[model samples]
Target chain A: MRQRISAVVIGASWGGLDAYSRVLGKLPANLPVPVLVVQHQHPSGGDKLPWILDTRTAMHVVAPMEKEPIEAGCVYVAPPGYHMLVDVDHTVCYSLAAPVNYSRPSIDELFFSAGHVYGPGLLGVILTGANDDGAAGITYIKQRGGITMAQSPVTAEARTMPEAAIATGCIDQIHDLDDIGTVISELVFGLGA
Target chain B: MKMPESVTDEQVSIEDIEIRLLLEAIYQLYGYDFRCYSKASLRRRVLHRLGMSGMPSIMAMTERVLRDQQFFVTLLNDLTVNVTEMFRDPEFYRAFREEVIPVLKTFPFIKIWHAGCATGEEIYSMAIMLEEEGLYDRAMLYATDIDKNVLAAAKKGIYSYAAVKQYSENYRRAGGKTSLADYYTAKYDGVIMDQRLKRNIVFADHDLATDQVFGEMNVIVCRNVLIYFDRDLQQRVFRLFRDSLDMGGYLCLGTKESLRFSACEEHFEPVVADMRIFRKRQLMKRETR
Candidate 1:
């Protein structure tokens, strides 16, 4: 049987961060699912990931820990220069690999792995980015019977990414950044059902 | 600065002086401190702003920017580069575990700043560390970036499932305690990170290029985000980060980034030397930046 959504995965670049913050900030503390973020970033150097998100919203955001068991109601970010994936048993995993699309934390890497692990239980969101990193991943989500959404062109900083996903005609909703929270909430709690 | 002669019919007009005067007018009318930015980059960014605003000349744009705060804000958006992410460097996280965590155990309530945290991945990564180390409950992480759009993404904490897999092995090498899967449940095709990790974080739009100091912090990490700047811009940022550190506070830089050539290099000693982590010297009093 298809389980209700237990996790949400988001991919973005360019103008993505601001949009993500607003949506995550609106989510209440007791959200039913966990969230994972994979943003395209440089692979070497810098500070901790959790600290950045902690200040942006009330959500308890943290970077993925190698070998850490995935749990609901928390947020996991992919570390830089590594791919963020889910193990068969639902634990977070990271790896260093050659850049896909010249990006270490390729959105495709995260989406495909999660698609394999979560099957029909996943929900994917592609936000504003400069390139088409998440296009193939969105297709994977759709094929697996998972819900998919993209940022509307009106709100995207660089509409190329969301537009690319939309071109496949596989996306369920193309939402404005401001309205994304509603989509997530509805999916997470089966709200309005 | 030498005055440039705009001689027409033997009448000498100082065109260069007018440009300097324009900059001063911008400063006086608006609070933007572009006076110290590299002349070339500032010129380019200002020119771009001018084009976007459909001004016929820099003089006209300057006049408008001086009058409207919103215009200045738009100019500010173009001036700063707000590009970054969480645990931006996989090796840096690995090194932090190997080198820094052993020492961080001494602190009670750790205060950290992700300076130039364009999109806030660094903030999220640090919070995860504190949690794994049992320090999160008492920790406060501050993430700042100049770009409003990126800051919003850092706040959302949602990602696609396919792309996150790229970092799977990196997580395995970083000493992740459980399957990465346990932290989030998959949906549609993406993963929404858990909210609890963000509890102690505060993401704000801050500019190291022009903004004043925020507060003393135990660690300040500004990564690959700074390479886009010129030497002078780098120096200015280094000074700001230096001023914001508590005694012996840690400073982490991008892998390709270093403090060796920075004006404030002497202010800090290497912690994880190879990882570009530094410890601020205890004796260095906070300078009046």
Candidate 2:
């Protein structure tokens, strides 16, 4: 049997807002897998993302606080200016220790921490972006026996990030942006395919 | 640090081994302790420096670290990047002006401690606030950090002139009584903060992980510093902050940080929840925050 995914990490940049809306909007409510996302965003605009995504998805969407308990069926957005990482007891932790790869809530930081936390039950997806932030991170997820995937470069609003992830030679599948969320719901909750 | 119960020496990879050894070497040679820092973040910083140095391994980097004092200083910049801005998260400052300063004004004399006050952005910001509120003459601000280099920089109070625009905006939003421009004069390529603010400020080298209780204070603001430390170190600092604070003194943390899960939670109650400002409570049973 395919190991059920327990957590999902999504990363994107450049054209992420509309693309995030698409992926998050299409997901079912009972997405047993916890979803965490890191999108390169300006620190000043920290207020609106979770609110915007909440309208798109049935899942409980939030920009979690320091040491907040991470639970299933919720989407946590990494707040701008602070990085979101997982702790030993599975709490959501925030960090201010400078930016990685020029992004504060770096995709690599989230993916690496998720791999450490969920291990074999992790699924990391690299969506549209203009840079290669998540490529090596997905590679690391693959190393930890977690599933790795990339949004189809052709379907992505900007292909650089997804293409970079595919170039890692660790991606298990490449699916269209619209279908990726359905695939995840199918894998985790047996809802959509 | 990684939990000892879950990881063995063998489970930690060679890269991790190199990192541990490097940290050990740095400690043994320099007496600067970073061993208690968060493992993942420490790993990232070491790897970044390792790559920048173009060394094949962290072991090699450690070798260079021992041989060259200058290289170590360069590594220090990478490791302790004090990347902060003035009046960051303007809401917190607005909160300070409206909610905190009023309570502080009641005191005849005020002592403020800005622990882990990286590059002194917030200290200057605090000084300006006190000056506006007519409390500057009576307040003494102790600014401290682990890195002596950053402490020296904090003392200089100079910043890139370009940053003034954003700082001005934040100052206005933070309820500044006077223009933000009033606090600094333009230098060659930067702006030097008004030297008058430095009169009551003391910049010192202090480590949260390995330092003693420095003083009794009415407010202890250690924002964004606890996030770097592990659980044990965080608790240690909380205890330090708790003991050092006067009864009913304020404790301000980074907007994202909390004492809710910490050992020190029982000693503090939220002054304003949204602003992350807490007041020291009398020793009592753990009630709700």
Candidate 3:
């Protein structure tokens, strides 16, 4: 019995640009599920991440406006200095609330919100990062009956994040950095499809 | 028997139902309408409070909120995110000076409303800019927030010295013509803003969710406040702002927010698109809401 995945949320911090490029580049443009990415950055950082990701991936990449509806086939990048959450109404909303774990766009904020909204239909992925932000969020997704994945710490540019997630003992699968995108595509699209 | 797809799809979790009841209880007991707020952020805040208070669940918290006025106030503070800084986004101020100031100069007397002006840092920033531009004497700034405590603090016009040091850098980057030190005096780890800056300002408790429009204004600055609200509540606030603005008046929102999806979108034209500064259209006749 295969569950239909509704959304994919990916989180990365240090060495995120290269990790995102390599992973997102593998997913086809016509992917059915919307991919939301939270990459740790400074509050005053440039808004060029979406454009850079767009150049690498086939899917449309955007830093969504407040309350923008979540659409399939587009990759949403969390804007700096704001916590991005998935509303129950299937729209993306931003909050100016105080930072969690010393990060505004905290991976836990996104994952917890998406997990609550999507429930069993959610897919949470933790990638290379220097912090333990996504560990708690992975636990949340697993408790919500959603699937969780982590890039193997050995292959990650920064092992702390994925290692932390794995330590939560919630992740469903562990894949190498090179195979993460392929695993995601398989889980979302199914092998036969 | 197989569960119907529609029934299963529409099912609400017990936790979600409890949160809804808590918000409803808050509205009924305190007259604070948070029912229309975005649930994701609200849930996080509520859960945080629950953890801190060591409540068994949201249901237990709801019961406490109903009976304990003090606990309710604490929950209200958590619900309303009041994290703000002076000249938080310098680029918005820079754009305001370049794009909106020229138009504001044409008006004889300026009326500016800073809705949801938490602790009044942004209001002071605006006052300083307007004073430098020679508009402060002619301007009456209304700084409002839902929290009366914050409003009282805003009236005092004092901030941490360390925070003010960072704001000075922002002030310079925001095209300040003179020294930021000229505006405030330092006193033992804290800086007191010039009392004159408060002369033309009025700090009041105005709830955007419930209160009616107070006056017609030349400019409305409500930044990062709308993100806390749901779509319907945001549309209601947008309509309120639209009706409150004079013809050709300016409306400034946070950088991440946009008027494109609101019902009043057609009534305003973008003055500084990147900065989210919009101008009310002159030709459109006002329609009663």
Candidate 4:
């Protein structure tokens, strides 16, 4: 069976905004899969991430809503104070849970769920975070034959998270945030096409 | 002290017992203590792992995680964070060269602890700096982090070509002797860093949160990593760094992060105040009086 990448799960922390802005902003509107983001931010306060991100990029962004089905060409964020998970039917689900890796809207939770539903059909990207939160989930995606990428530690504002993923021996590539869009485009165009 | 047979017993529900049991099971089975990670991050990481394992619930995931050692390793990767870049803060590199590298020339051998060295970028940056300063041959660099996965990547030294542009700029700002482009080869437009930079570099798994100091270091560069930690954790890490450094050693932190409010502030004197670099001080004879 031919594997198709239908979804992308990305995690970021610290200097993630610049990378996210570059990658997410450049995403073509006709993309075949939905891009889900988990950017670590304050629990009680967020400065209109969707708007800020929207201004920088072309991708239409919105925080995922409860029970909403995943959609292509749209970006879904794990809103503050929630762990966004994809349901069995590919619907987005949210919960008011305590922070993970000391963060709400954790990238691990989002990637893990996507890996479960999509298995090898998912692509997990771990970018600029301060702690070791996404390594395990990225490995899980790879275990199910999903593609995984980590930000080049040199380019990350905070290298701990990407370093953690790389340490797992599961990452396929390490790219700077600026070039991540090209990788995503390649994946979207389908590998080995 | 045995209870009577007629005593009523209350059974704990599996769901209620599951979260706690899973956390405990991970600790007992794998020995990567995650019991202290913030609740939200832990819950999020475990739940995601459960989905990836195809286990119906945390309990099922726990059973598999405990029984399968490999699975536990996978769980650890998910639970930990792995986001990083090399020369992340370009100014810091510039500061290191201007203020720190000059002082390092006096030492016969240099031991640098790049605490939280994710994917080895900073270590490589340091290697480049040391090489540029004619010190690479005499330096032993220790790149340590709790993330085993990233440590492995740091060892590989491969990167995407897209990053080279920013890295090139950062390199120039940090005072590069040669082209940053010279560091890696172009393969399918992807970048593979020079293997020479990794020489004498040891990438290992060490947690600053709970683990004791592994070796004495001449300088410790634990940058922006401290911002994520609470005050107590920061204090603990500062103490660890203090203990790990030799007298007259150097301590470097992230641009926004500082040791002024830390419990161990008195132990270090500012070397480059604005850059957040500090030097371990030898107490004056008058202080003893």
Candidate 5:
């Protein structure tokens, strides 16, 4: 079934840069949806993730300036030291609110907010992570009728997050790292070319 | 199979009810407003407090929060997380000192508000910057926080000596004109801020979530505080700051916070966009027709 995915939310931590490079690498230059990502890193090193990802991906990658628009075909990384949420108004909102699950830019905050706002139009991907941060978020996505995907635990560098997400019984698919991006493209643009 | 119509889904949970009632109880009993905080963060904190308090659930926790004065203070501390640092983002200070201070030089006097200034690190930083720039004598800083405990510490102008090492690094990076050691003296485990820094500062209790804007000012430095608020409250605070700041006054937000979706965005122009510093537009007064 080809349900339109208006936005994609990706959550990763611990081994995220490699996971992001792999996934974002496969995305086409003109994919027609906004992609928001949360990759937990040190409180001071936000510039590195987007800088690194921009080289590996076709899409425009940025750690957006405050109040920057959320545009399609652009990849937005959650800046360090803040929790980022996709507003119901379709703009990205950042918060310095206390950490959730000991993470400033917690995967749950991004996924849950995007899930609530985008609802069935959202697709959430939980990537390699050390902690169980994205579990409740994927559940929220499911409750909102959004599609959820997890990198197959067997293929993940840190399988805890994927396994936890799968435990929620909300993931629509558990995919190999190589196939996850392809699955997203097929879901968003469909298989027929 | 269809779901039961009588059963309400995730939109309304038992915890949600408990949280609502808890917030209401706190407001009615203690007059501290948590009603407009970002919901998820509030819930997380309340649940954390619940776990720490060894209460069975939020309902039980709410009862204790309302009745126990000491416990309420703990809950208040949990709600307002003042994880702040001196020269937290050194770039912000550098931008303000380089760009904004030049414009302020045109004025005879300057009034600055350190809104939600957790432990006054920002207040001290600003004081030092202004003093070095030859502007502190003409500047008055109003430092405020919702949590009185933090405000008390801020008033003392002392921080752990261990932490001063990082602060020194931050001071230099923030374009400090003189050595940071000139401003503070070490006393055993903690360092006492120079008394001159407090000469022009007024520390007060101002709750952005509930209180009214006090005095008009030339510049307002409210950094990471807005991140704790939901959109509605954020807008309310923006409007308050807009009203509090004189036309052409400066407003510096958290580096990560933006005015893109703010209701008051039009009233200000970006001074340093990437640093989240904005200037209120100098609107022309209209002649009556």
Candidate 6:
């Protein structure tokens, strides 16, 4: 039986821009669920990721305002120097707390919050990166009965992130970078047989 | 594949309930309201305190928190977000100098409130900017925080020398006219901010959660502080800011925060939208017949 997915969370670090363009760029403009992305970046980094991703993806990408409502089809990217968490009330909240895994917008923080809130209605995706930030998050998502996916190690620009996530034995699918969008679309829209 | 019945589901719900009760206990015993704080972050902080205390659970921690004043104070420190740095978002400072300063020049005197001024890094940063702009003598800066401990630190105006290097870089990027080193004298392993900067500054305890407005100001900078609050509390604070600002006063929030959904959204217009600088709208003139 297929469970209804409410939100899709994608986490990446090193080489995330290219990976994001490949995966998120393919997601349809009329997606039924919100996509939250946490890409590790410098603390002083400006809010340019959303604008860059907005140019690539069909979905509307934005650096969400504090306590902004989670809207369908919109892609919310975590701002630098802050941890983005999903509140139980379906709003995005930013945290100035200590960085986890040396990352302010840690994937683990977002995943833990979203998994706890969305439970089985979340789809957690781990993409190309050089760290193990998203591994624990994927484990939590899986434990919460959410679907988890990872980019195949060979296809990833930096395989450590996906490899680490794959090592957790929690991921439901391992797809090539190019095929991730299609799989996500299928999982979200139930487009496949 | 069929999923197993999750035991953690029950555990999660139970933890959440315990947390709610714990917050309620804190509020009832002491007036520091953590009830309206964003729960995800609040829970993380509470659990962190619980872990450090080596308590069994939040319930057990709450028992100690209610009985012990010192323990509760430690918990309050954990609950309040105190992470701040000098010129943290340099672009915001740059924008303030460009857009807000020109208008501020028109006023004979300026009153600026630094709400939640943790450790006073940004307050001193502002003082330096004002000093460079030749507005320091005419400016009265109020630095306030809920935690007295950080406020005391803010008053001391001494920061580690290691952090000062990054602060210098941030100062430069923030369009500093002179070297950041000029503002502080080096002490033993630390730098003490210029005493003159503190002359016009007043450090005090002000809780946005329950405190009333004290003064109308030319600018109110409460950055990154509102993110911890829930919707209702945020709205209340927004109204407080709106009422606290004189007509045409500038309001600067954190880079990522917005006034879009607030009740006072229409009360101010964006001066630098990217930097989150806003100006309170002037009152409508009565028609002259």
| Model number with the top DockQ | 6
lDDT of model 3 at position B142:
99
Q: Give the true-contact fraction for every prediction, in order.
A: 0.00, 0.21, 0.48, 0.02, 0.18, 0.56
CA lDDT, every model vs. true structure: 0.71, 0.85, 0.89, 0.76, 0.85, 0.90
Using TM-score as the measure, the top candidate is: 3
Per-residue lDDT tens digits for candidate 4, residues B1-289, read 2211211112212433676788788777666666554333355556556766787888788888777878877777666655445566677788889888888898999999999887777788888889889999999999998877788888988877787676787788778889887777888867878898888888888987789986788999987566445456778888899889999899998654667556687889998886789988876787532
Clashes of each: 133, 0, 0, 40, 0, 0
Considering only N, C-alpha and C atoms within 3 Å, which residue pairs clash in candidate 6? none
| TM-score, ranked from best to worst | 3, 6, 2, 5, 4, 1
Evaluate candidate 1 and give its CAPRI docking class based on DockQ.
incorrect
lDDT at residue B223 of model 5 (Cα atoms): 91
Over A70-96, each residue of candidate 6 has an lDDT whose tens digit, in order, gives 999999999888999999899898998
Residue B100, model 3: lDDT of 86
Ordered list by DockQ, greatest first: 6, 3, 2, 5, 4, 1
What TM-score against the true fold does each predicted structure earn? 0.49, 0.90, 0.95, 0.54, 0.83, 0.94
**lDDT by residue for model 1 (A33-92), tens:** 888888777654443656777777666786654445678778888777666666545765
Q: Residue by residue across A1-193, what tens digits does model 5's lDDT show? A: 6577889999999788899999999999898988999998878653578888999999999787544678889999988888888754576666665788899889998887777677778899999999999898888787777788999998999999999998877788999998988888888887223
DockQ of each: 0.01, 0.33, 0.46, 0.03, 0.31, 0.54
Task: Report the Cα lDDT for residue B193, model 2.
Answer: 97
Runs of candidate 2 with Cα error greater than 4 angstroms are: A1-4, A26-30, A87-89, A116-120, A143-145, A189-193, B1-12, B285-289
Per-residue alpha-carbon lDDT of model 2 for A3-72, expressed as tens digits? 7778899999988988889898878787776899998998887567888889988899987877677888
Off by over 4 Å in 4: A1-193, B1-20, B47-57, B227-233, B283-289
Give me the runs in candidate 1 sitting further than 4 Å from their true place: A1-193, B1-79, B185-189, B229-233, B283-289
Q: What is the TM-score of chain B in candidate 4?
A: 0.79
DockQ of 5: 0.31
| Consecutive 10-residue window with the lowest summed lDDT within model 3 chain B | B1-10
lDDT of 1: 0.71
Model 3 residue A127 lDDT? Answer: 96
